[model samples]
Target: MHPREATAARLLKISAGNAYDPDVDIDWDAPQPPGIMYAPQERLSLFGTPLWDALTPDQRVELSKHEVASIASIGIWFEVLLMRMLLRHVTGLDPRSAHVQYALTEIGDECRHSIMFGRMISAFGAPAYQPAAVHRALGRYLGATAGGIQTFAAALIAEEILDALQREAMADDSLQPLVRMVSRIHVVEEARHIKFARDELARQVAGSSKPRRLYCQIVVARAAYTVTHSLINPQAYAAVGLDPARAGAAAWANPRFRETLRWAGSRVTTYLQELGLVEGPARPVWRAAALL
Candidate 1:
């Protein structure tokens, strides 16, 4: 078996002791009162936007479904990536055992996250959409690459993006308690993952050549774009019985989408700036994307 797969299996074994199955773990009978999960003002970008108000009740429901699926899919991908990293660490290819172990714990946390999300879909009777092809390809490429620092950087970028969304979700007091709980749990664990990723990136970049640094920056930037664009998948809309093409087009064109991207980019840019990774032409692009 591949080294990463082996490591993932071992971690799964250790953490599987108290595994919670979605079928039996969650409170599916929990009450869901009829009201907006989040207030209009709670959504930073969509608040008072003409486009947002134009959405029908069904459309809004579809959008909410998309949001939950997006978060769950990304969470699963990150767990798999963490498993790969653990394999590298165990083989002595990387010396960051503590960080890798912490990430493994997070992976276990995400397993529960996936279950929660899946259960949410089951409760709502919405079909689950798969991740976008582009995003899946990007994740596969990142996972297939062999290098500790590179993997760490990819993971860092991902965690930073997630942190941005979680912050927004947590700030929205109008969100359902169950939704808020999931966001809170994710934010807590991601805080540690982000710290580990940033520290590792800084350590790796400190003595790197100019060319290597530039390469790393490019990789990180590409990963960010890949993730951001993936959020606009049409399948998510279709899964919830909405018109995929029209809804996706409207969603992609919506200013709220841009705002979501900005929210995600800002967190990434902040970390890059703190690490002194921003340089040359790429700095302006990163800044513009964040500040947009």
Candidate 2:
């Protein structure tokens, strides 16, 4: 077997023993502790801005709930994109191979994760935040066309950013019980998927021709920008009775929020930089996305 297949074989065994059914594993009926925030205050988009200072503590907690829902909504969106891309990825490959089998396993994980996110949103009593029409169109395009390095790079961008935040969240004892449980489950399962994608991405980038490499650089950078910018829907602010436009402007301009973006993107960005996929025409886009 090739080295990639060997890695997948190992992953498959680990998954067999460790995969979670969120529906069964999570205590959906558990009582949430009152006065707990849904996410860390520092991670909230408007956390340090004037708008944040203007809100009462209760309002701040409310905003965190909505923001967590918005993030979960985006997670569902990206996982759907990932499911489609993974299907396309294995279409022409040997189905019996460990690599193909692991890809399908990941698809199963993503499907469960999407459902889990939807349930969490409903539980929060928040609106299901959809991406803007333009971004939905871009997602459709990427799902249909992204392959190899482009596919895995986009996967890493979304997964890594969320992973960074979730890792912190799961360990924070002050967060809502449900939020912490969900984060812990996701973080454990996603560790395998991240390794799979990172290895596959490195292989693809090493073997890709120059023109294909350049195209992937720009395309994946655009995806990174889109995903980063869309995580906090302006409508989330509106959910808490704030002006959507004003709150969004504050979030985009807030230095603390920008720093959070950088921190979240740092691991994946560094990896992609080493692979040469985050450079050339993509550098500015990464910077503009506050992910450089």
Candidate 3:
């Protein structure tokens, strides 16, 4: 069998043993802890900024809750987009192949996850925090066209960033109970998905010619920029009573926050480098997004 098929088979075995139903597993009835953060304190965009220092503790917690929920909302949007992309790619494949089967299983997992995120947003009383209107329209166009290694690698950017933040939240004792559960469930399942993406991406890169690799690199960089830049909605600050314009500018330009975003991106960057996807042309795009 091809290495891609072999990797897919291995992932299928893991999925069979570890797949989850968030609806059945999470206890939605428990009272989510109020007066506590919705994510780890440091993961908040303005965490170390002067604006963060100026907020009252109650306001900080409130903003953290909304910010975390907004991120989860973005997760839902990306998950839905990627699932459609995956399904579209596999639709013409041999149904008997492990690659096709694994794609179907991963889509099932994403469906549950998208539902879980929607539930979490409503449970926490957060507004439907979406990306800017422009991004939503762009996502639809990209979802239809991002079909190859670019799709998987771009998906990794979102998954790994969220995984970093969620891992922090899951370990924090003071975050809301609902947040902890969501973090835990997503972290566990995403591990398998990440593995599958990495394996498939490496397989594709190993075989493609220089021109094909270059094409993939450019497209992946653009997609990565779009996904990473859209994660934190500046309006999330306004929702909690801060001046969105000022706060968003501060968060983007803050040294500590830029470092945090870069750190969150480091793992993916290293992998892309190993795959020869982080060439000179792509570096500018990644750096512009503060992801390099």
In terms of lDDT, the best-performing candidate is 2
TM-score of candidate 2 to 2 decimals:
0.99
- lDDT per residue as tens, model 3, 1-292: 9877898898899888987687788888888666877877776789888899989988988888888878888999999988977887787899999999998989999999999999989888887778777778767876887766877888788888888888888888887888888899999999988998888778768878899888888888877777777878888898768898898899888878888888888888888888899896988988888887
lDDT of each: 0.60, 0.93, 0.84
Candidate 1 per-residue lDDT, tens place, 1-292, comes to: 7444344345445454544454464456877556555222333233245545776765665566556655566556656765675466445434344444555565566567666766665665545556677767767777776355566666766677767777777777776655665566667656655655565567677768888877766666666566555544566655446576776666656676677667676766666767655666555545444332
Candidate 3 wrongly placed segments (more than 4 Å): none
Per-residue alpha-carbon lDDT of model 2 for 1-292, expressed as tens digits?
8989998999999999998888898888887676789999999999889899998888899999999999999999999999999999999999989999999999999998999999988888898998888889989999889888878999999999999999999999999989998999899999999999999999999899999999999999999999898999999998678999999999999999999999999999999999998888889999989997
Instruction: For each candidate, give its TM-score against the true structure.
Output: 0.74, 0.99, 0.95
Better of 2 and 3 by TM-score: 2
Of models 2 and 3, which has the larger lDDT? 2
Clashing pairs in 1: none
RMSD of each: 6.2, 0.8, 1.4
- Model 2 bad stretches (over 4 Å): none
